[model samples]
Target: MDDQDILMVSEAQIAESFDADGLMLKPLTLFIKTEHPDVIERELSVLGFFSISTSTTPEKTPMYEFTLSPLNT
Candidate 1:
């Protein structure tokens, strides 16, 4: 995603969403908005890097939430 499509979520909000386990790294959640949600979804799905979920604002604006975590190899 480009800089324009990304919305920065606050550190406090991220901390609140996740539990702390000092030994482990935290997952990152990205909030992305785009005119073509389907295209973005398809692209991300092809990459197979993130766990994606979708939602829409009250005004029917599409938002994509992508969560990335360390993979256990």
Candidate 2:
């Protein structure tokens, strides 16, 4: 994937997408749950999250990144 194709989305958005489409229609780049750690543990495990911390702002409010697993069945 190229830099232009990258999209960062939260877990809620991921769920919404999955629910609306019944599956992931497009490839997801980084899956994030924001400052919510509990959601990360339960929601992102199936995607095989890499669980990396990122600083989205200058104050660096800790953001979480989940590396998605292959969706192909």
Candidate 3:
């Protein structure tokens, strides 16, 4: 499969999703977003060595992000 497809499949496998009010993203989530931003940017951008996005709700504001690179990447 293409890289984008691979990324989508991988995210699906992990069942990762963020709530509008969530404060933190799990390590695995950050790692995946970091490693796959180029392939995944068609939908979202993973910034600051991890995927970062503003909350759709004004109350949520900025969201802190984190991630660890895969051993194989």
Mind giving the per-residue lDDT tens digits that candidate 3 earns over 1-73? 2332221125552445333553333435332323344444434443434443321223342222323323322
How well is each residue in 1-73 modelled by candidate 1, as lDDT tens digits? 3535656467875776455763224566666776776777788678765455665555554566655453431
Report clash pairs, candidate 3: 46-51
* Pairwise lDDT winner, candidates 1 and 3: 1
lDDT of prediction 3: 0.34
- All candidates: CA RMSD (Å): 5.6, 10.5, 14.8
Q: lDDT of all predictions, in order shown? A: 0.60, 0.47, 0.34
Error of 3 at 49 (Å): 6.6
Better of 2 and 3 by TM-score: 2
Q: Would you estimate the TM-scores of all the predictions?
A: 0.46, 0.33, 0.21
**Residue pairs in steric clash, candidate 1?**
none
For residues 12-66, what per-residue lDDT tens digits would candidate 2 score against the true structure? Answer: 7567435464665444446343555555556556455233333243345444444
